[model samples]
Target: MTLQTVILAAGMGSRLGRSLPKPLTELSDGRTIMRQQHDNIFAAFGDDAKITTVVGYRAETIVEAFPAADYVYNERYDQTNTSKSLLRALAATGKAGVLWMNGDVVFDPRILGRAIALIERDQSFVTVNTAKVSDEEVKYTVDAAGHIDELSKTVSNGIGEAVGINYVSARDKKAFMRQLARVGDQDYFERGLELAIREDGLRLAPMDISDLYAVEVDFAEDLERANLYV
Candidate 1:
């Protein structure tokens, strides 16, 4: 499979109150967060996997860190959210599908390998964590048939938290992008996925990743928790 990676790394980590861009922040293992994602995805899929990173805040710094990754700059990154960032990155991909992730996520390389294997089997899906969820986490619910019925942070009765790791297959790419482009800058990429599901019959079932560790770094506590996991 041609596993292309599109990583959204544009946001300034203002919530963390850090001067450095979030992706440039060093983790407990001494690898910068973006470097870790880049290294691990390549490790999981081999060097043949094309890596594309969408950058804005301190984009030069990220480019310096991983020159090998194809760069897509989100000029309106400050005003836009994941939906726009992802759309811009996807355009640069020129592929029918891609393995997408947030730049701040810290996880086991095997998770990437597992996600790819799952996509190879099913062709499309999103990673989910069924064991644990918090009010702050982006949650999702799968129907009795195991197709994702709803996905958003406001889903109070969710069955799992979305890990922000997804496989967009060639078959679903056009509809996915159409929904993504229909959204406003304030909306999340999840909104686009939801639109795709409702209007385009996109079925992004939940692939359990509860057996693996994956944490998105958004605050100091999250950073601490991620370090401990690593």
Candidate 2:
């Protein structure tokens, strides 16, 4: 089966204080954040990788940067959040499972390598960093069976932070999309995951990548830290 990847790049990223889209911000190694993501996806999946970027908040800039990627525009990007952007991409793709990440994440390429087995098994999962669980970041809790039970920034007693990388299996895609549509406009995509788990019995797994570097560049300090591994 071909590998499908989606990059959620619709946010304005106001905290980073960047004029350009956050994904276009330059990393220490000279590659833009999205460029590194593109390269990493290709490096892991080779020619089988099919990338679709959900664009808004200056969509033209991202389109111009990677004309090769399939594009899905979020018309309400300014009013909505990652939930809507992710819904758009999931709706646009075919029946295959999709691997997606926040566009601003700067991650080690090997992280994708670690997820290959789960992807191959058609498992739905979220990559997590147990080393740090900031209150502001999305966090997760597991069920009795060790599957993801709760997911959101507000989750209490969260085991770790969701690193913004995730996969929706073909089996669970329809249910997840439905939940995404049901969530509030301003909610993050994790809200949809939470609803899916509660309403549809979606068994989302948490894949730990704490040993590898995966930073979501939300602020200038985050960019500085992400650059350390670049």
Q: What is the C-alpha lDDT profile of model 2 across 1-230, one tens digit per residue?
A: 47999999988999999899999999989999999999999888896799999999999999999999999999999999889999999999988899999999999999999999999999999999999889999999999999999998888999999999999999999999999999899999999999999989999999999999998999999999999999
lDDT of 2: 0.94
Q: Which stretches of candidate 2 lie over 4 Å from their true place?
A: none
In candidate 2, how many Å is residue 52 off? 0.4
Evaluate model 2: give its TM-score.
0.98
Query: What does candidate 1's lDDT look like per residue over 1-230, in tens digits?
Result: 55778999999989988888898878988988878888888788887888888999988988887887789999998999999999998887775678899988988788887776666764678889999888888898876677987888899788889998888888888898999999999888999898898899888878888998898999999899889976
Poorest stretch of ten by lDDT in candidate 1: 115-124
TM-scores of all candidate predictions against the true structure: 0.96, 0.98
**Model 1 steric clash pairs:** none
In model 2, residue pairs whose N, Cα or C atoms come closer than 3 Å (at least 3 residues apart or on different chains), thus clashing, are none
lDDT of each: 0.86, 0.94
